[model samples]
Target chain A: MIEFKDVSKRFGHTVALDNFDITFAKGKITGLFGPNGSGKSTSMKMIAGLNRPDKGEVTLGGLQPQESKISIAYLPEIDYFYPWMTIKQAAGFLQAFYADWDEAKYKDLLGFLRLEEGMKIAKISKGQRAKAKLLLTVSRRAPYLLMDEPLSGIDVLTREEIINTLIRDYREGEQTIIFSTHEIAEIESLVDDVVFIEAGQVKLAGSAEDLRINKGMSLLEIMKEEFRNAN
Target chain B: MPTSRLGMFSKLYSKEMRELAPEMITVIGLAVLAYIYLFFKTHDYPFAVIGPVFMIGGMAAFLPVISSFKLLSREWKNNTVYLMMSLPVKGGMIMGAKLTALLSEYVLGTLIAGVSGFLLIYALNPELGQVLTSSIPGIGMKLIELWPQGLALYLTSIVIIAYIASISFFSQMVGKLVSRFSGLVTAVVFIATAYLSGKVGDLFWLNIDKQWFTNGINTFDLNVINQFLIINLLFSLALAAVIFTLAVIIYNRKIEL
Candidate 1:
């Protein structure tokens, strides 16, 4: 589980997160929906302990994000593999550090992702690299997973492959997953909960079913109406 | 399961070494080629043989410093710092792995150069025995004559180089800490600090009884020259350790862009 309590982050005079408060329960896929620069990635980074909040706290499983880092796996928006490292080498390198890393899972994921073992990450296509990054993170078997823009640059088919792989392989009871992206429709069916962030603040959040029932419309329509009405 | 500290360190260090292998190989290969070319051209076998050693050692010594600059800077440029900072490992561990790998590469490269140089010299000049005997001043010199001492001295130079490398790594990390302009500031600060520290230390003692200084002002009977080497070694290692530690702390607390 993760909780952000009055978390505010600022870069110079620009606020990246503004008094944002939200809680993500365990065993569910929570979609962090926002446009570019909506602080979705920033929030996920804070949760991953990549960036510290200027005020308040971001806690995972009752500990500060940084302290709980070992228990959480993070996949950043961009590809993270060292350019010169082959797929197998990168996996081996990561496996050496992460105690819970599952080698079989990584191999299986690689097979599913259709990535060659000996191919250097730099030489691979961008989508393949993204898949490799995902494979690396998911194979860690961390209790919480934070994925920032994992499906951003991939084709629709590849996105579906990724979503299915994530759902089928990593998703399990009592394991929390928070993913940030602007492509809400792509993940609409997979997400159990939704947090709509705008202007560094959480404007809407709750169970997807609850939101749909109360608003009498699909989540996307509600989101569009909310932004339009705010403006 | 708990892992041994040495095992973890070795694993991390090895990973870094592998990542840097391409660059290391290219540099060493170039040095070898240059050495061979000079060996045939000058017909001064010793100089040609020694040429590669010096070139390789110099490259080995400086490559880490240069590589580290790019490595640290790339994190910011590529936006991978966010993911790196989020990992569970301590920043010090990350830095230690990098430094360890750098030193390992330097050591391995130097050894290769030393061995190759010796072989080349021996092959080109069959009068290696005469050269050794002629260079010695006396029995002591004869006892210690050969390339071994030179090799040892070269290794010592690497230690000095390593200290400088640590300073560079620390400066780069600090530069990352302060902002974009802080990189320039860090370079300036390092030069200014080094200048001031050296000047101040010299001002306090201008060769005033090296023995007295070596023996802590009381035991003046101790040999100053021997003590000086020990003191210098200790100072260099200490300075390296401190800089490395500071870099680790900054890296640990660093906020990824």
Candidate 2:
């Protein structure tokens, strides 16, 4: 379980997260839903241990990321792999750091994504790089998978493939996945719960099915309504 | 147990060294190539006389700073800090491995220049054993012949690179800690470091007995010169350790972006 207890963060005078409190439970696909400047990426980065909260704490499985980094696999919103690395070298690099790295899973994902091992990350297309990021994250058997904006800047079919890969390869009751995306419909069917945030505050959060039933609309519609009301 | 843990960080060091290979190879290759060009151009001139200066002092000017900037700025510039920071390793280890790889590059560059310079000396004069304690006035030959001097010089270089890289990391830390006027803060820090650099840099050329160590070069006290160089190298290394520790603390607490 990942928990943010009264956590707050700031960049200069601007507060990125304000006295925020939330927890992504074990074994659930959660979406951090928010538009740009709404603190979605900030919250995700905090969870992945990229940013430290100025106030309060963030913990996964009752430990800080610095203490339990081996158990978390994070795919950031931006391209994060070295440009000079080939797909194979990139995988090998991860294999060295992570004890739970699954070589077979990596190979399978490479095949599924139609990516070759010899492909240089720098030379690859943006869409291909996205797939490479996904493969690298999923190939780890980490208990917590934090993916920030994993679907941004990809085409329709590639997004579909990623969604399919998530659902198909998801290890229920074993791996917990939290992904942030503003495009609600892209991950609507996949995410079990949703956390709606805007301007550094959580406007709405609950099980996806519960939100839909209570609001009498799709997650996308509820998202629009919630942020609009907050504004 | 500690060895295995270090092995993991060593793997990172190796990967970083590989990434640095291209630039390192280029500098060494170019230095050697330039030496060859100069040698050919001045066939009638003493190849051994000016070759060492062009290779060591000339080709290597400002290389430590350049190499440190390239190694340390990589993650933030490429957006790979996310990957780097997320790895199951402490910030110190990450920084250490990176510094080590960079040190390897710097050492290798110096070695290549030194070796080629030595070759030119040998080609001109086969009796290389006395080059270190040459009756002739040759600072370059003294460096290659005296192991203590060579090692002291190399250690000083390692410390220099360490200091530069640590300052760069601190700059990132300062930027994240205070986003407003970050540019101004960085500039102030850079200027401050530059101001103090000369006094600190004198550690590399520790000539307590100026004329005895340099000047005609043959009238130097071996014991005194070696001891002074050793003291300077130790001082530089300790300062580097402090800077690195501060960098690690800042990285853990305040480094963002």
Candidate 3:
């Protein structure tokens, strides 16, 4: 489980996360939905130990994010891999650093993602790169997985590819995944819970099905409604 | 804890060296090509190869600043800092590995350029060739006698490179903090660091008055040489520790990206 207790962060005059408090359930898929600059990335980064909170704390399984990084796998919103690295070389590089890295799963995901092992990261299309990032992140059997905008720049076909691979590869009984994206419809079917954030605050969060039933709207509609209400 | 730490650093070091090789090759390759071109253009004149080779030796000293900046900047510029900061590694290990890598590159570049120039000179001139042929043992002994000065030069070069790179590393770290004028801030950091290093050097060694040199004793006494080496070395090491600590603190605490 991951917990944020009154966590707040700011960049100059702009507040990224405002005294935010939330706890994600263990072994479930949670969807963080927000528009641009709604603190989705900031919240994710704080949990991944890339961004420190100014006011409070973010913890994973009773440990701080930085202290538990080895047990957490983070898929950032940007293309962060070295451009010169081929798929095989990248796998080797990760293998050296992560004791939990699964070689068998990595090889299987390479086939599932249809990424050639010899292809340089720079040469791949953006959608393929997204898949590559997902491949690397999910291959680690981490207790917590934080993914930001995994489907942001991909096409519908690639989005489906990612969605299918994530569902097929995820061991839900043992692992928890929190993924954020503006296109909620793409992941609406997969998420067990939903969080709607606006202006650096959480406006709505609960079981996805419960919220859907109570509000008589889909997660996407609820997100739009919540953002409108917050504004 | 220390064992795993060392293991982690070893992996980081090898990765850095691997990434650094092709770039190093490009610089040295260009220098080699230029040396050849200049030689072809000027070989007809007396002692002309020496001029071009000497230029190669001097051109690489300025690269540590640029290399250090690039090594630190790419993480933020490419958004790779996310992956970097998220790793289960210490900020100290990451920064230390980078510093060590850049330092090695600087030292290796100097060695290559210096040796290339020396070999070019030794292989080119007929008078030198004849002297070497006639008195090989004498030439070898003379070269052996140059060891003290050579060692001093090597140590001095390493310290100087470390000092410049530490400032460059800190400037890049500070660049991530400011909203604008990062380049200007980096320049200011560079200038301030250099000025401080000079002042520290002056303060510590000015106490060693010229009376040592003016004494009736021989000018190149072992004590005098040892005093100069010891003072310069201590100063260099002290500044290196300060700048490196500041860089690491900024890396661990201040950098957001």
Model 3 lDDT per residue over A75-181, tens place: 99899887878888767666667878888998899998899889898999998899898888888888889999999878999999999988898787688899999
Q: Per-chain TM-score of chain B, candidate 1?
A: 0.76
User: Which candidate do you rate higher for TM-score, 1 or 3?
Assistant: 3
True contacts kept of 2: 0.61
Q: What are the lDDT scores of the predictions, listed in order?
A: 0.76, 0.79, 0.81
Report, in order, each candidate's fnat.
Answer: 0.44, 0.61, 0.54
Q: lDDT tens digits, residues B1-257, model 2?
A: 02246667877898788778887777777877776765665556554446454546445545656666666667778888888888888888888888787777767777778777766655555555565466546333444556767677777777777777767666555655665786577657766765575566675456466665564345465776676677677777776777678778988766765
lDDT tens digits by residue: candidate 1, B83-150: 55765678777778877777777777767766676666776776775766664443344533435545
| Residue pairs with backbone atoms closer than 3 Å in model 3 (clashes) | none
Ranking by TM-score: 3, 1, 2
TM-score of chain A of each: 0.96, 0.98, 0.98
lDDT of predicted model 1:
0.76
Tens-digit per-residue lDDT, B116-150, candidate 3? 76666665565665554453352334444546756
Off by over 4 Å in 2: B1-4, B47-57, B124-147, B180-184, B194-221
Better of 2 and 3 by lDDT: 3
**Each candidate's DockQ score against the native complex?**
0.52, 0.52, 0.50
Clashing pairs in 1: none
